[model samples]
Target: MQQSEALCPKFEFAFSILSRKWTGLIIQTLLPGPKRFREIADMIPNMSDRMLSERLKELEGEGIVMRTVYPDIPVRIEYALTEKGKSLESVMREVQKWAQQWVDC
Candidate 1:
């Protein structure tokens, strides 16, 4: 089946991913650089490891994120944005700008 079709019959694309509580945050985190699984987990301290892993898997399956495995002593895996994921950067930036107007750091 097609992508939209896969998400259909129940949860649509928006509700399936973007509408999730921490999904947007995870996308934002990947904007900076490729991050390891632990890095994403650390960045999103409130989100459980299982939840993060699930989200990553979901995103990967959606063709938004790329999972890279390094050949080394142990093995290091990292997650980075695919072209589709990077396309959301503009949307994220706009959201950031809007939030900054109210939320102060």
Candidate 2:
């Protein structure tokens, strides 16, 4: 057992991203399809506009979400998960299953 591992046994880089507040739920919400800003905000009940904007920016910085702005009518904007983000789907699903199984006990 190494000194570093002993001191921080659960210091995982991937889990760091997964552990962020609302990050898991946000990723789950986007699994169905891409969405506009307002659409996402509306769907996530009680999610403040400011917090959503900030989290989206953070996810974008982390390469999990891609934001696109269109130049056509109404200047549409949309957000979608990147390949990196899609990779989390299965991980989240397994976690969901485990949680439900254990939490019910």
Candidate 3:
């Protein structure tokens, strides 16, 4: 086995995705339900629209987020967690609980 993969393959893979900026938060936001692109963007302070779009696309590529478009005059689009994405809820909540207990902020 490769040295890095042997050490902690699962963790390495999970962290590679979760550690990206705004990724965890995006997952958290989607836990409630699907939301529009703008709604997700608004949840995070100081996050640029461009960045949000980029992150959403990245998550979609990973099969963690699904994008749906409605046929409307304005072309409304929304983002939601797929079954794969919803799988991370427990992990995220565990992290939140850990942060609550240990994080200074």
Candidate 4:
């Protein structure tokens, strides 16, 4: 019998981000385009504002999400995928396809 090698560091790192609660959904939500914080909260039902805020910060730190602040009567903010984040579109789509086919929930 052959022993399996340890997971690649890059793969491990990627999973570390993806495996976080609400991370993938947040990424998916932003895939189409930029959105305000409230928009994201609405799209992903049941995710608390605090959790979403934390996850967005994590993603921003990861260079996956870019947060933009607009100056206006009320300072508006929006979150969008960076080029690095946009790169995950194919991966996310593939996961969605798999989930549709095999995920029971």
Candidate 5:
């Protein structure tokens, strides 16, 4: 590791979180608006219900995602981004732009 990377632990920390599997995708999915658990799952192809649930919990714990529960027959739940999470929108957009330029699909 470079000396600068070692010195700037915050960058490393942020990169670690964003680099995790599905973290970026989850954030991207929530960028539009709040959504039900199933809605998120359906948006991301090949995402398991279990993995989605786990990532949501982790994001919630980090204050990046907000989970709301409504009282109903079976129970209704929705997940949305908090202010902190919304702050990442620009970053996500930049990534998307970069991917478009450099990655061939």
Candidate 6:
């Protein structure tokens, strides 16, 4: 029998980011467009503000998410996906399609 090859490091890194709790949901939620802190928190139920904040920061650091701050009277802030993150749209769509067919809620 042929030997199985080891997992690719890039795939491992991507999986590591996606496997984290709340990461996928956060990315999915931002797929439509940019959203404020409260908007994201509201869209994803059961995710604490602290956890949301933490996950956003991690995604931002990974260059997957872009955080914008508008210097207004109240200082509006929004989170959106960068080009690198937006490239995952097809991947996300595929996962959603697969889940719809195979995943039982």
- Judging by lDDT against the true structure, name the best candidate: 4
Residue-by-residue lDDT tens digits, candidate 2, 63-101: 999999999898999999999998889988998999998
TM-score of each: 0.82, 0.82, 0.90, 0.92, 0.91, 0.93
lDDT of 5 by residue, 10-104 (tens): 88889988998999999999999999998999989888999999999999999999999999979999899999999999999999999999999
Window of ten residues with lowest summed lDDT in model 6: 1-10
lDDT of 3: 0.94
Better of 4 and 6 by TM-score: 6
Per-residue alpha-carbon lDDT of model 4 for 1-105, expressed as tens digits?
A: 334676678998898999999998999999999999999999999899999999999999999999999997699999999999999999899999999999998
Across 1-105, the per-residue lDDT of candidate 1 in tens digits comes to 778655454446555668877899999999998999999999989999999999999999999899999997699899999999999899899889999998888
Candidate 3, 1-105: lDDT as tens digits: 777556677788989999999999999999999999888888997888898999999999999999999999879998999999999999999999999999996
Collision pairs in model 4: none
Local distance difference test values of all predictions, in order: 0.89, 0.87, 0.94, 0.94, 0.93, 0.94
Better of 4 and 5 by TM-score: 4
Top-TM-score candidate index: 6
Q: Specify the poorest-scoring 10-residue window by lDDT in model 4.
A: 1-10
Clashing pairs in 5: none
Compute the lDDT of residue 4 as modeled in candidate 3: 57
For the record, the alpha-carbon RMSD of candidate 2 to the native fold, in angstroms, is 2.8
- What is the lDDT for 65 in model 5? 99
Q: Which residues of candidate 2, in runs, are more than 4 Å off?
A: 2-11
Total clashes for model 2: 0
TM-score of 4: 0.92
TM-score head-to-head 3 vs 6, winner: 6
